[model samples]
Target: MQITTNPEGRTILVGKAIFTPDEVNQGFEQVYKDNVSRVKIPGFRPGKAPFKIFASHVGIESMKEDFTEIAARQALKEMLSGKTIRVVGNPTFEVDSFDGPLNLTIKVSFIPDYELSDPSKITIAVPKFDVTDADLNKAIDNIRGRYASMAPVDRKAKKGDFVYFKWSVITDGRASDRKKEELVEIGMEDFVKDFDKNLVGVKSGDIKIVMAEISSGQEPVEIEINIGEIKERILPNLDDDFAKTLHVENVEALKDIVKNELLEQAKDAKEEYIESMIAKALLEKTNIELPENLIESSVDDEIEKLARDLSKKNITLEMYLEKRGINEEQLRAELTPKATNQAKLDVILDDYSKENSIEASEEEVDQEIEAISNAMKDARRPALNENDEQVRKNLARIIKRRKTVGYLMGKVQLTEK
Candidate 1:
């Protein structure tokens, strides 16, 4: 067998496997034998039918098709064995003139070449915040608001007020007919971009129209928003009673708890920002030629995982294809870039782990297992035994990855927020 690759541009790779008559004949004999074992003739029982007789009965063309398919599958596997080829989807196979040399063409899609920079040199400014008395008070109010009850207000909506409104979003000049009613609090950064800004000074009887940009097809889309009604937030009074409701002794104790929570949140956010910065810097600093085969394989795996997840939700892959308005080829094309990025991140993280000598000890592994067991117990699930070697080994890997991330964050300069 002879193999050659033809680049079809746009990341599509065509691998042609040309088989000689000897190879084809061998495959044909195997196919005939395999079929003859299960098939029966009028006067002959299974496995007793001669190849010549079976070929005469089944027709040469039909037999050739079956044999060729099997041969192609085997040949393709052999051809791809040692190559780092990332196949975006299932290969499209074409047998060009089987009567000749049994030439087969297989098309594989994948992401083309791209380079990522090192993380150390990439500079990013992280927002820093100092925990102050006002900040602590604000955090306590936020906590209270989580458990706050809303009452029907007779006034207009204002800044720092929660508004429940019905609205429709126009995406790419096409207005959505579905009515989206969400409870949005003004001044909350968690709300979608420009949402809170549009809600300010709006009344219950008024309908406000606002425009915002949202992600659409690889670009930002200007969306027109139509607001229905707005209602002001009715926060619970922060007092001794509120503290008692939160299981705290008094307002002072509640404030302390809120402050500590805020500090922890700030620390986590700072660490996350630093990690992101480091990843960016490292990618910029290092230049590695990615294995194309790996990216394609990862994309295929991602697609299969997506299909399985959708299946669990009682949706078929066809349903997803229809919803996305894309064919299998288009879907694969879209996933190629995503898969490449994920592969790059994985490679970088793995390299970083090895370079830093990151490892989890037996005690750490045991602790992780215990933690998981406790969590499962709390969630009313079966507890995993600490002595289970497989479970411990798996937990050890997880703990090691977590510790590596923590260590990397600590290595970076973090401005506390």
Candidate 2:
């Protein structure tokens, strides 16, 4: 057997496998042995037929196709053995010649080999945010919303008012089924179509009809609103009393604390922005070559993920597409570019990790798992065991990627603006 590889592109490989006459003869014998018992030979029982008779009965020339497959498999095994190429899928085989040397051509996808331009030479601009007094004020305002008091008001409900009411689907001319109390923050129903518009002028004990579109991609539903209580939110004045309630010294001390928090958030946001810009720059700088079948396979995985995500919401991909007025082809077209880019990035990061000998330590995995367990303690979710194979693998992948990103951050030139 002889093998020769020719790259059609950086990633797509076209190779040829040629079996010698002796090897071809051996392949025929193997095929005959494997299939002889499965076929009906006229003069003898299933496995009792001689090779020449079996070949004559089955058309000896046609057996070349079966032999080609056997040769192709052996060729691929020998050709790819000990090679570090990340094959995307099984190589496809094409018979080159059945009569001479039993030749075959094989094709497979490998993640592209790429070179990165000097990271130090690449300039990336990262946006920086300065925490101002206005930002502090906004932060304080958000904190105020937490301690806000809602008191029933006699006037007509207005914007920013809380409308505590019961609503039911009006079937025919009467209310149908049960009514549930809904506390809606008026003036924020843009997500619910015209819900707030219909309730803004209503007073306590005043009934109204609202057509609400609760979820996007769905038609509006008509419901009869039974107004119960209309209340206005009262935010406590920023004073020593408010500070004491929050376990702080005084208003000045509270302002200092909140201002410091805003500053820290701004700093964190700046770091995040820098990291994101660095990643974008790295991808653009490297501009890795992506294989078509790799892109296609990635898109397929994305589609499967889309289906799973929809299933979690009690919806199906078919339903989502129908509601969106699109087909699977159109959805695939939309997802193709994103999937392609992600696959390319994964390839580059994997290659970079290998070249740099970068890896995630067991300590990092343990810490990540501990953080996950702590985060989910409130939900009472199943505990994650760090020693679990899949858990460790997934966490290690994420951690190594972050570490790789950090390494690239050190390699690049970041300008904050």
Candidate 3:
């Protein structure tokens, strides 16, 4: 057998597996032996049939097709062994010309070779973050609101008042049967912006309807609220007593706690922002040829993930697409860029891991699993046991990726902004 490869694209390969007449004869003989016992032929008992008779029973063309299939599959499998290319699914086989040299063409799709940009050249300006007095004051205000006392008021509803009412949400002119009581904190636009507009200045027992747009898609949802009761919140003065309520020594201690919390948050946000900038810079600087099939496969995986998330919320993918006024093809098209970027990023990271010798040792992986288990309060910890082979492999891969990214991030020069 003789094999040759031709490139249709950067990631698409057309492999020509030209078999000798002797090899073709051998393939035919093997196929006959494998199927002879199951094949029926007149005037003979199963395996005892003559080659001519068997060929006559199952047409010569069918025999040749079987021979070609077996030989092509074997040749492609042998050619792909030990190759670095990540094949996407199975190859497509086409018989170019069986009459001459038993020629067969196998089209294989794979991720093409890619090289990441030098990590030393990648630089990002990471902002220096600190918790200021304003941040502490903002946090204190939020805490004070949470501890505020609410008491029933006979007067009309006003800003900063808490209103208890029965709400019915209407969508596309259809009223939902899921009526429930809800509370709206007046003047807190984040809680209910439209509610304050229609509920303020209204006395108890007043019924009001408000049209609010939540989602950009579909018609505006109509909110019907039946005012049940009104209450005004009384906030305690921020002093030593308020600090004691939060288990702190005094107001000074509370401020310190809030400042520390804010500082930690600022640090986390800065790290995240730097990582995102690094990813964006890497992608922009590196050039990779992605396989079309791989992108499509990634898109399918994304769609499946979306379906699972929606299923958890008791919604179907079809229902979501329908509500968004899009077809499956359109959704796939919209997700193409995301899938492409993810595929390319995976290839880049894999290459980086290999070049830098980044690896996750067994001890490191075990420690990671233990840390995760300790952090989780629910049954989720058991789902990542080191005893599970797949879980361990996944954990190792994740750790390795993190190590690679961390190495790259360390190499990057950060310009403070």
Against the true structure, what is each candidate's TM-score?
0.61, 0.72, 0.78
For model 1, where is the 10-residue window of minimal lDDT? Answer: 213-222
Measure candidate 1: CA RMSD: 7.7
TM-score, model 2 to reference: 0.72
Number of backbone collisions per candidate: 19, 0, 0
What digit string (tens of lDDT, one per residue) describes model 3 on residues 76-186?
A: 987786777778777889988887469888989987666679888888988778777787888998899889888999999998888888878876766577888878877
Better of 2 and 3 by TM-score: 3
Per-residue lDDT of 1-417 in model 2, one digit per residue for the tens?
889888896888887888888888888899889889988988799899999988888887768878887788888888788788778866798987877578888898877656866767878777758887889898998899899998989998889998888988877878767998888889887436667888888888888777777567677878888888888999989999989999999989999999988888888887787777765776788867777888898999999999999999999999999989999999999999889877877777777788789999999999999999988887898779877999999999999998887787788787776
Candidate 1's residue-wise lDDT over 1-417, tens digit each? Answer: 888877787567777888888988887788788898777677888888888898888888988899778867876787578867555556678888788568888877654544444334345568775588888877777787788676666676777676776666766766678867678778884556655787777767565556544432234344444444555556788889988988899999888877888889888887777767776666666664454567777789889989999999999989889876799889889889778766776666765677788888998887777888899999999998888888888887777777776766655554433
Note the Cα lDDT for every prediction shown.
0.73, 0.84, 0.84
Candidates' RMSD to native: 7.7, 5.9, 4.8
- Model 1 off-target regions past 4 Å? 4-15, 73-92, 106-126, 146-157, 160-242, 282-340, 350-373, 376-417
Distance from true location, Cα of 332 in model 2, Å = 1.2
